[model samples]
Target: MSTHLNDGSLTPLYQQLMEEIKVGILNNEYVPGEKILSEMELSELYHVSRITVRRAIEELCTEGYLVKQQGKGTFVNPRKMSRKIEQIGDVMGFSEACRACGMVPGAKVLTVQRCPVRADEKRFFSLDSEENVLYLQRVRTADGEPIMIENSFFPYNAFKSLNPNELNDASLFKYLKNTFGRTPTSTSQTTLEIVRASTELATYLDIITGDPLFYMNAYFLDQNKEPLLIGRQYIVGSRFVFNF
Candidate 1:
């Protein structure tokens, strides 16, 4: 760490400290919610002034990388949020991914409601007058670990008598195949802007609010190219990472 910093480098000493700490967190050397060393300890450890350490910590806190308790020292921020990007046109369900990864898939159904489709959804799904929609919200987990929060709207009649609780450990695609003899052969997904985790979402996922998170909107289609499911997923960046 010392080799990366130069006294004559255009960067300030505090900035160097912040960059090193940031890298440490990303590399998992410093974990989220883990207390950092105190000012005096950091000063001694880095051979820097206490003021420099304080400034460095303050900048990190303001940038949402660290949290400071009134009486306690600062702590590394919680895990980075994540999303898994499937190959284009590949069809799989949330539970299948968890199962394949050797993790048990779990879900907590938050709400079930019959509602008219929103305007944006209408255009996206090309809704017909005959199609009735049901809104489903569930927090998906793996091996009892919170991973994603799903907000979806499906055609009610296609999944008639479906209870959200019964979806545990069952892939949505598999259910479609078994119950309705339908399956999604392909899908289109779009990732939106990165955003800070919300209080409710963070609480559900056991992370601090304002943590980094990824947002995704996906459209699933059946073998016949008919829309099967349209949904949005809020992924926990820390729990999962993807290459594409």
Candidate 2:
């Protein structure tokens, strides 16, 4: 790697530095989400002034190639995955969305157990006071990159046969469809909000604590309009895009 910059070139020093950094990113010299050299280190390595290094870093950030976390250093930005949110009839799962964006989808089951029904779960599942609900938590990924934390709830009696071991790296939607003949076709209700990541969520999504996340609550229904499941997802804000 040539770090020497031409002082005689007509191109500004900052632009030259920017190009070099961009090339480094393109060549996998700086992997996604990996922190880059500090301003002083970059200045020394590129033989440029601190101002020049700062300007280059700023431009890279503006171009979406880098991101600056408060008090933490600048890091490479992951490629944002885009999902189209249409009417309730056009619901898409995370795996389908990832494939549409030319990325591989992955999931790691974090927790699976039968838990006492919450108020909302009872209301959605029409469960009695004594009934419990099946709770499942997973770290959803795209191309080996952690993207979201998925917390899903299902009627315990209806899904008690689910094998926790099979959920690792498997699509719950597909499993429900194939095993129980229950297909989630549309969402009956959906809401989106912004929330700060808790420590556990940050660890799961590989983000800093208090980072912004897109919190989504959705009630899913089968084709016959029968309720199937409820989903509460916390997605990394900088790594996802939603089109309405």
Candidate 3:
């Protein structure tokens, strides 16, 4: 509401402008996907220099509160999806987490094939070097918005009966539980890190190349403590949050 910036304040002009714009977004003054005022207009309105306005906008974009489109303008970003990391005994899948957040979960199967097992996969599943594994890649969505890319591997001999067609827009965990009587109850190991989106990943997740993403590698175990599968997920940083 207040367009005037106080030069007397200790905060830098750019930071002050950033906070004001953030407040506008939170207050719905700037709706998601709505193009915001140009830097020149913002500078004129706030009585600040163009450099100050540019810095504020840049920071907001980096923080995921805004997005800049080439030739177009800056727009407000959609709210981030959230997932909680609970105790070891409590594990939640993407679909379950989306449902809990009151969003419709969907998946688009990207790739399904049998691939030679990597050394790590062989060790995790206690398989021989000659064994192969069923690999599945999918783009997961919440309410029709692409959120993450899921790369999962299952022991071919045990889950060779899996139907790839059934995976589209379906819950893999639920399917495994009902069809194979195998429920993923826990994760033996999980590692989290940040990664830049590749061109292919950018296309899949509908994000810009080099955008930040959260990469997770997890080894899952069934209810009976049997090795189940390995998951490698690349989540859109601007559209997802991890609650620990």
Off by over 4 Å in 1: 1-4, 70-72, 86-105, 118-126, 141-149, 168-186, 194-215, 222-226, 234-243
Q: Which ranking of candidates, highest lDDT first?
A: 3, 2, 1
Off by over 4 Å in 3: 1-58, 67-76
The lDDT for every candidate, in the order shown, is: 0.76, 0.89, 0.91
TM-score of each: 0.69, 0.72, 0.77
Candidate 2 per-residue C-alpha lDDT over 81-177 given as tens digits, one digit per residue, 9 for 90 to 100? 8887634778888888899989999999999999999998889889998999999999999999999999999999999998878888888888888
Kindly report which residue stretches of model 2 are placed more than 4 angstroms away from their true locations once superposed: 1-76
Candidate 1 lDDT over 40-154, as tens digits, reads 9888877778998899999998877898988877898765433246555675577776766667888888888877767766765777765668888888888788888888787
The lDDT, on a scale of 0 to 1, for candidate 3 is 0.91
Which model is ahead, 1 or 3, in terms of TM-score? 3
Candidate 2 lDDT score relative to the true structure: 0.89
* Structural RMSD, model 3: 3.9
What does the lDDT read for residue 152 in candidate 3? 95
